[model samples]
Target: MNAFEEEREMMLRVQQADFVVVELTLYTDTHPEDAEALGQWREAIKEAAHVRRQYEKRYGPLSLLSVPTEQAIELGWRWNSTPWPWQR
Candidate 1:
């Protein structure tokens, strides 16, 4: 695939992983006694981090919370340099 396609695909994966984490967090908040849901929520967080790392490795970062890579710094990547996810 071309660069844009690859970037879009990775971004989608990131979004899906984040969605799972958010949903699981809400579920756990309401069902705190559910060990199964809590476990799933923990796993979801890890998966989301993994997906985020993969995307940032290729496309800088989705947010400022992430540490910028040396290459990205040298390349002058700023948050305003590109469109945000919703803007895209």
Candidate 2:
């Protein structure tokens, strides 16, 4: 696959992990002391972050918060050329 396709796939993976974490977070709010849920949430968060970093390294930044200094310096206004992560 091309770089764009690969990047989209990685972004999808990260999105899935983040969704799982959010779901687990809501469950933990009710359960409070569910060790298993908490552990799964932590794992999901870690996996999401790792995939995010990988995406950033391979394909520019994913969001304003995760923007790398090099990307800012190198790409400047070119980021607008690409579609947003949530967009088709």
Candidate 3:
């Protein structure tokens, strides 16, 4: 495969993984009742966490949603400066 193909494949994998983790997150958010689901849910969460850690270790810092990175601009006197939505 070419570089574009390889990059596209990686992106698709990341997207699919994020979708699975998102479903698990929604379940965990309302993780009150349903003991059986809770057990299965915990396993899912654990698996997702492992996958995420592996991805991050291979790549750089990343969010679960795969949001594009917003970089910080540093200026000594200016203190704090950040990326705007348009910049992103």
Q: What do the candidate models score in CA lDDT, each in turn? A: 0.83, 0.78, 0.52
Q: What is the lDDT of residue 88 in candidate 3?
A: 23
Q: Sort the candidates on lDDT, descending order.
A: 1, 2, 3
Per-model TM against the reference: 0.83, 0.76, 0.45
Q: On residues 2-88, what C-alpha lDDT tens digit does candidate 2 reach at each position?
A: 866877798888888889889999999999899999998888889888877877776667777886547667767355776655563
**Evaluated with TM-score, which candidate comes out highest?**
1
Clashing pairs in 2: none
Off by over 4 Å in 2: 73-88
RMSD score of candidate 3 (Å):
7.3
lDDT tens digits by residue: candidate 3, 1-88: 9755654455556566667767866876787586877776777667666655554444423542433322211212221333221122
Residue 85 deviation, candidate 2, in Å?
Answer: 4.6
- Among the numbered candidates, top lDDT falls to 1
Predictions ranked by TM-score, top down? 1, 2, 3
Model 1: residues with Cα > 4 Å off, grouped in runs: 73-76, 83-88
The TM-score of predicted model 2 comes to 0.76
In order, what is each prediction's RMSD in angstroms? 2.1, 2.5, 7.3
Which residue pairs in candidate 3 collide?
A: none
